[model samples]
Target: MQLKPALGAIVAVSMLAIVFWQQTHLDPKAPDAEFTTLSGEQIVLRELGGQPVLITFWATDCRACIEEIPDLIALHQQFAHKGLQIIAVAMPYDIPSRVKQLSEMRKLPYTVALDIEGVHARAFGDVSLTPSSFLIDRERNVVSRVTGRFNLADWRARIAAM
Candidate 1:
């Protein structure tokens, strides 16, 4: 009985340590990070400087991410001329070929990049979850972040406010 309690305590302590470590290292707002395009070209976050950007972290296999693609495309078309740049950063789990196939199937019209090293996701914080999005303003400041599904109306309102 005593041994069981000791083992349980050890597990609890280990879990706590992991939580603390993740929380301490995660950055909610740090915009300047290097990104690579699906075409094997490199770009920096500042490349979108002086423009409102919507950076979406996604994966090809994620159902929610796939479902949101249409909405995202609509948003891109609706606001592209209004200084809104939608950047879809595909997670490294999905290769360039897969990304291109998916984009072609979905008819995605915005700028899409490949996070082959997942460095961009880490710079913004670990985004293992699909359909995670960050809205960054012209100054490279993260204005808002959304996990899971997001509504078009909410995004429209936020962009209008900016």
Candidate 2:
């Protein structure tokens, strides 16, 4: 028995839809979500309660996002001692190994989290594009959000004024 090309395509598409539907319906957030550090230790958000946080959503494949990483590293170094925490949330994609490799290669001093289910993205407001940043105050309230490539000078100035 041979299947026609159109029928084969339809079956393949239907299977793909089912897989996407299942994955999409799953919740990505945990009330107690704990992120693993580069050294493989898990740390919960509540642990960093007293410090302001800069959360950036990015993907390994995003060129524009990759370009801002060095600046982010600079910012982290400059403000970490000032009670500021920088968290890079890696968007869900097929590049966990690559992300880890890059993080190590860059020698990132800040924490990194994997958005395996996009829960962070939705909870923080679906930052669909890469390099989106959210500035959360010490109280965990989002004070500012920026999408697309950003200027480090402007970001630092805003945080300094806060």
Model 1 lDDT on a 0 to 1 scale: 0.80
lDDT of 1 at 162: 70
Scored by CA lDDT, what does every candidate get?
Answer: 0.80, 0.74
lDDT of 2 by residue, 101-154 (tens): 988888888888787777777765555667778777766656666677777888
- Per-residue lDDT tens digits for candidate 1, residues 1-46, read 7999999999989866754564465565555877766666666778
Top candidate when judged by TM-score against the true structure: 1
Name the lDDT of candidate 2. Answer: 0.74
Task: Please list the residue runs of candidate 2 whose C-alpha ends up more than 4 Å from where it truly belongs after superposition.
Answer: 1-33
In candidate 1, which residue pairs get closer than 3 Å at backbone N, Cα or C atoms, i.e. clash? Answer: none
RMSD of 1: 5.0
Where model 1 places Cα greater than 4 Å from the true spot, the runs are 1-28
Candidate 2 TM-score versus the reference: 0.73
**Model 1 TM-score, 2 decimals:** 0.79
* The 10-residue segment with the lowest total lDDT in model 2: 23-32
lDDT, residue 45, candidate 1: 74
Worst 10 residues of 1 by lDDT: 22-31
